[model samples]
Target: MKKILYLLLLVSIMTSCGEYNKILKSTDYEAKYEYAKNAFEKKKYTQAYTLLEELVTIFKGTDKAEESLYLLARSHYLNKDYETSGQYFTHYYTHYPKGQYTELARFYAGYGYYLNSPEAKLDQSGTYKAIDEMQRFLDYFPHSERAKEAQDVIFELQDKLVYKELLNSQLYYNLGNYMGNNYQSAVITAQNAIKEYPYSKYKEALSMIILKAKFQEASQSVYEKKADRFRDVIDEYYSFINDYPDGPNAKEAKDIFRVANKYVKE
Candidate 1:
């Protein structure tokens, strides 16, 4: 019985494939549209995308245009072709501002970028684009059911930007006074990151970097600049502790402060 069932399933699949191929070659737009919908429903996104791609322009300005365009975007999204999906979604919203799928198009256009955002080590243009899209979604649909999710994604993307800056700052710190004053560069980078992402989870780490960078900068300065630079390090250490009394780097910060205090007179 199982063998017979399997044979029947194989025959059904072959017949379905044959019919789909026939439909693909036909000029019958209505038939193609119906088949595309069915293919999408069956999760055959590649087939659906192929069929919809042909019909979207044909159905333009027709009653089927809105749904056809939206389906084209969704098919790409379902296929995990997020970049392509984002483009289609943007097209849909731009053309059909008040269409039935406008909300979804706006949300997914940005959400697709978020889904495709690369790691912190990689270029983060996609992450920034995602944040822009999601922020626009919030501005347009503040009460949308997906608003909170969009907001959360924005926060996550911002964190990624902060982390990238953190890595840059650390690199500068590691370079130290290799050829020039890299510690100054590290302090500037960390301070900018702290200002840009005041609520970032990396806030403490950035502050710590600033303090350490200042100490190193002072330590390596010429005798004429050492006392004033060390005093700057002491001020940075106090500000770091004020913000995070029990911070993970408290011990290190305090030790640096103790050393810096020895250089600057009361």
Candidate 2:
């Protein structure tokens, strides 16, 4: 008897919930808009999204339509639905440029992409997109309060990009070392440092190390070799001196070249 009563009560509650859902779905714009606004104010983002989406569609040409659309985007953002939020924020910016929430929408659009960016070791599609949008914001609103914050975010993302590139170059250097063919490695490392960090105070020091490592590796092969192998070392020294004419390594490379040339040819 008690089990039968519980079953009946469960069915009745489910039917009531179904009827309430139908009523909510059939509500008019004024009803939906007020509900959405109240839900948003109370921080009920999921409920707000459902109501505002309905209100925006039903109130199409009215001023509230634009506000409803903007609120719908914000609701998704507050719910941490970043990709969906980004899409709706983009729509709001495009369709309602002069809307009251335009600047906030633009700010959040970039912020949403930034929040969605992957780890530094992963693909940086979101990072790059956020950078582009944030830069536009800074350019369009140089005096805005968010400009400095935008610039800071740009610098942080840029540093991640730089670190990733440096890691790749370092890998190449490591591969070159493992092959005991430091010549190519040294050249690649020096070129990478110049290309990626030309302003680095360490650039000259890095170039010097590449030259030294290449010369040392070749010369070690030079001294511990038979006649034919000795010739290869002498040729390398000649190449090094010709490539770096005025560096400290150039003078040493020249001296090694002359001695190798004389003995190897004899």
Candidate 3:
């Protein structure tokens, strides 16, 4: 009985493949499209897109063009080809402003990139693209059902950029003044991140870095500049504490302030 069941299953697989091949060879584009749509419904993404690739162009200017293009993009998205998905989705909305799938395409075009956004230490071009796409989606569909989700994603991606800047700032601080004024670089980077993403969760981390960098820069300054630089450090500590009066880094910040205040006094 098991052997009989196995034979039936094998036959079913072969017959299915044979039918798909027959459809592939047929010139009946409508039949091919029907089969692709069915294939997609059955989760045969590769087979779905294999036919969709040609049909999208063939159906251009026809009633089916909008749907076929959108399906092609969605197929790529399900297959985890985010890069290709993003391109096709962009194309879909660009060509069909009021098309049935325009809103969905716009949403996924950016969301897919957000899903593929790289780590903070890596290149952030994709993250930037994701932010741009999500922003565009919000601008065009402010009242969409997906509007809240898109807005949240935009904030998350922005935070990723902030995290990247935080890492850069930390790197500069670590380098100290090896061959240049890296502490100053660290301060500049962190400050710019704060200015751009004032509401980011990393604002506290960035502020801490700025305060630390300022202290380091002042502590290492030449004798004549020490008094003036420490005064600057005192100013930064006050600013950091004012913003994060009870933040996690408060203890360290106050320690720095004590040293800075005492130095300026002497």
Candidate 4:
């Protein structure tokens, strides 16, 4: 019985492959197009896009062109070939501005990149592209049903960028005064991150970094500059504590504040 089932399964697979090959080699465009649509519906994304890629060009200027292009893009997206999908999606909307699937094409174009966005530790070009594309979608379709989702994606990608900057700031802070005053660099990077993403979830963390970097910078300064630098640290501590009275880093912040105050006992 198991042998029979195995033979049956192998035969079914062979038949399916043979049918796909026949359709792929066929000269009839309509049959190929219909088969591609069916393949996509069945979630055979690679097969669907392989056929649709050809039909999109063949059907250009015809009624099938719009849908063929959109389907091709959608197939790539579902296949997780996001970079390729983004290109095809962009092409679809550009050529079919008023086409039936334009709205979806736009949304997927950006959302695909969002899915492709790398980790915060990696280069953020893809993340930036995702945010830019999502913003463009909002501008074009503010009332679109997908508008809320697009906006949310943009915010999420922006937060990723802020987090990347936070990592850089932390790196600088950890380096301390190695070779030069990386603590100041840390403070600057953290400050810029705060200014750019004031509402980020990382905002409190950034503020804490600023306060900590200022403390370190003051601690390492020459005796003549220590008093003035510590005063800056005290001011940063107040700003941090004011915004985040119960922030996660409050205890360490208090310790820094105490040390900073002791230094400036003028």
Q: Best candidate, lDDT-wise?
A: 3
lDDT of 3 at 239: 88
Residues 4-61, model 2: lDDT tens digits: 9999999998985574476477756576678678878988798789878778778889
Clashes of 4: 0
**Better candidate number, 3 or 4, judged by lDDT:** 3
Local accuracy by lDDT, each model: 0.94, 0.72, 0.95, 0.92
Q: Taking the tens digit of each residue's C-alpha lDDT, what string does model 1 give over 98-203?
A: 9999999999999999999999989999999999999999999999999999999999999999999999999999998899889889989988998988999999
The residue ranges of model 1 lying beyond 4 angstroms of the native Cα positions read: 1-6
Better of 1 and 4 by lDDT: 1
Question: Could you arrange the candidates by TM-score from highest to lowest?
Answer: 4, 3, 1, 2
Instruction: Tell me each candidate's TM-score.
Output: 0.96, 0.64, 0.97, 0.98
lDDT of 3 by residue, 1-266 (tens): 99999999999999999999999888899999999999999999999999999899889899897899999999999999999999999999999999899999999999999999999899999999999999999999999999999999999999999999999999999999999999999999999999999999999999999999999998888989999999998988888899999999999999999998988999
The collision pairs in model 2 are: none
State the local distance difference test value for candidate 3: 0.95
Query: In angstroms, how far off is 255's CA in candidate 1?
Result: 0.4
> Which scores higher on TM-score, 2 or 4?
4
lDDT string, candidate 4, 123-236, tens digits:
999999999889988888999989988988998999999999999999999998789989889989999998988899999998998888888778888899999999988888
